[model samples]
Target chain A: MEKIISLHNQHVKDWKKLLTRKQRKKTGTYLLDGWHLINEALTANVNVKSLIITSDQLEEHDDIVTRDFPIYEVTDEIMRAITDTVTPQGIAAEVELPTDQFDIPESSRGAWLFLDQVQDPGNIGTMVRTADAAGFTGVVAGSKTADLYSPKVVRSMQGSQFHLTLRHGNLDEWIELFKKQHFPIYGTQLNPEAKNFRDVAPAGSFALVMGNEGNGLSDNILSQTTSNLYIPMNGRAESLNVAVSAGILMFQLNQNIK
Target chain B: MEKIISLHNQHVKDWKKLLTRKQRKKTGTYLLDGWHLINEALTANVNVKSLIITSDQLEEHDDIVTRDFPIYEVTDEIMRAITDTVTPQGIAAEVELPTDQFDIPESSRGAWLFLDQVQDPGNIGTMVRTADAAGFTGVVAGSKTADLYSPKVVRSMQGSQFHLTLRHGNLDEWIELFKKQHFPIYGTQLNPEAKNFRDVAPAGSFALVMGNEGNGLSDNILSQTTSNLYIPMNGRAESLNVAVSAGILMFQLNQNIK
Candidate 1:
């Protein structure tokens, strides 16, 4: 833990840049706020490169804060400057970039969720947490998606991202890689041709692709998929939320995968 | 379009107050921004008591504009003051209070979704949209839930609230009303005793009660439900997002109802 007073402080400013896609591209690392998130990362065996903690929250996690590490003493104002949440939990952390999702080994089990520019951090986080509960391989966040390491994503993931294999980058290239490996990709679409999620067997060596919260899968990614499917909807509304779609698909597909 | 420069302008300030639950309740209406949402409200035939638009966007949608009411012409700066979004889409609309959910006439044709303090505005909006698409008759926001009229909720709902009967009030009393009318209520829970969603059968009328995103259904709501159901997951994840769970449950139960 290190005290960061100056917003101009080198690390504080660098971490703040993680709020933008360009900054994340340049730095290759992002910020995770809240005490529980860091703890989750720790439990996931992620290397905690650095942490900033206020004096108050430090006492509660004394076991994690040994004498070897210095706990930062920053005012609430300073902590607020570092995070975007309405109420700062008085702690923030930095962890290494996640590995590529395509690198995932042939596990011969469980559903894998693919996100194509599913932009909202909260949606990305909730998907990861839901994915974890649905017992899937992991979530792969494609390019243009929200940074999983940002405070909102970290908080929304509820520590599930740490436990799950969260990968990022070009979705097209990764889907191609999966295709070469003979992995079946299930892309979501709305059309009469799309099969109902329940009618399809969830079991497989397959990945479920969730598109952007609005526009959905680009043609390139959709073409790479083995099957384009939809959750059967009976009402007049247009579509479900991206995270919710991912959750429904995950739960349904996981059943067949098992 | 009337331009108002002052931040303290009555309507300008009232729009900002929609960010919080208290102020939205004090006044029955909430702010809905963007062209897509406003267009949906018009198409859905949702009660739109007032519409705020830039002369520019108004020029594009002559079919929906009648020039009969308070159309606030606001500078970009003033628009920012009234909207929670980075860009207010050059148009914002005031939607009337939705009291029709309570008027569902005894669940004659579709299912109902009852939320218990899910609190996140985005989640609540997703639930409303899902319930609408899943053909639910309406959605009831139980006590402690997010305000239906919050800016985020209004945006997330994407005008689906106008398509169905959506209301916020005492959930227990609503449950009693359902029982009195002999309508079945299905609550999603993780208990081993809970039947898998697909296995359960719903009558012609039903309601799916979902709990908070962080916490599962409360004991009070759970106790009142006729059956506790679960969406089976074959994987390691412990839970699904609440709205997603409701979507799955709603879809599955709606099938049985129809």
Candidate 2:
């Protein structure tokens, strides 16, 4: 087995660089920290370019070590240098980034949650997991939303990224594609003319768009949606957290599921 | 205005201690940081013991400065030392902590969300906010949940703490109290006997209990409830984020609202 003991090693430095968005984009891959996420990636048959593990964890993960993928065993120090967690989980994987979605699949026909300028990585990740749990077709993070592959988002996603189609694209184009298929595109807002979200029938095919934490959906996207719906809140809370609101909407809209 | 330019000033030193759970509990107060939260505190008529602001912000906040509470103008450096943010918003308030609920109120009759050993501060706060938005009567954080008054929880709560009653108590006692009133107690879990959540009709009064992030409801609580329920998920996700699940359940059960 190959061993890497120095932080200055080429692979060690390159893996550490995966912490940043630019580095991730430049390499077309991102680091999946900890054993749980790495295991999920392998189980999903996702492209894992390499596996990194601390010397202590190498024996327990021998199955993966015996696999065809290149495995690098390193000291705890080297493992810590490449990962952000206070207590490094002693395992990580370099997984290739899935290609961005440019077109809706002909077989795609279920709920799709759209994020418009939603900035919190945790919120973005939680919403993805919610969409996945609701049996949604996919989640499209608009250009303005947080990068889905960022470390924070990846950690909060809890391996749901491997379960569903997560893509980044222009919201306008995605909306147009859904429109061509005669799917309802629901935008969430509190405008006077907006319909109560409950009034909308449980849907088999639709797009539910959630907006930024501070400012809601952009006026341009609002104008293009088929219907603007608001979750009725009789309480004094000014608004619900964007991710929580999305979960409520997605599950409520997905009631058609038996 | 009284000026506190040194970080070592008695009051300044004491205020910084508010960041620690022990100190907050000892002082019976917690710090509210930022202009938006401070404004919300005042509007909610929450007890503001005192105000602290940097010299740069004192003029713009003259209305607050003129209020009855003691006001102190401090150096920007001191403000930074007392806050966790990369850039402190130049305003903070020391507010008295509300006493824990020892017993359910005589007139209390509505939805109540209980947190059982939920450890993440962000998730705890988000659930509190979701409960408030769902028009719940209150939320009770059981003994094992994260500290409800921590700086992270306070920030993530986004001031919804003021909108509804938030209490810290024993889940068993609270559940017993609700049962005496004949309210349905819904414990979330996926058991062979667990009913689909949709089967429960929306009601004006009920208790919904959510469990720890890694574990579902404790067996003791699950066995005691009127009925254990589960959200139907046909997708590949193993579970939903606790806060998102709480939000979905709260809104669905809150359907009784006009």
Worst 10 residues of 1 chain B by lDDT: B100-109
Kindly list the interface RMSD, in angstroms, of each predicted candidate in the order they appear: 1.9, 0.8
lDDT of 1 by residue, B69-163 (tens): 56676666767777877877888877766555334344344578888989888778888998888878888888798777778888788878767
Q: In angstroms, how far off is A132's CA in candidate 1?
A: 1.8
Minimal lDDT window, size 10, model 2 chain B = B99-108
Best by TM-score: 2
Q: How does each model score on lDDT?
A: 0.74, 0.86
The CA lDDT at B142 in model 1 is 85
CAPRI verdict on model 1? Answer: medium
Instruction: List candidate 1 stretches off by more than 4 Å.
Output: A1-11, A14-29, A67-73, A99-110, B1-28, B43-48, B59-72, B99-109, B232-238
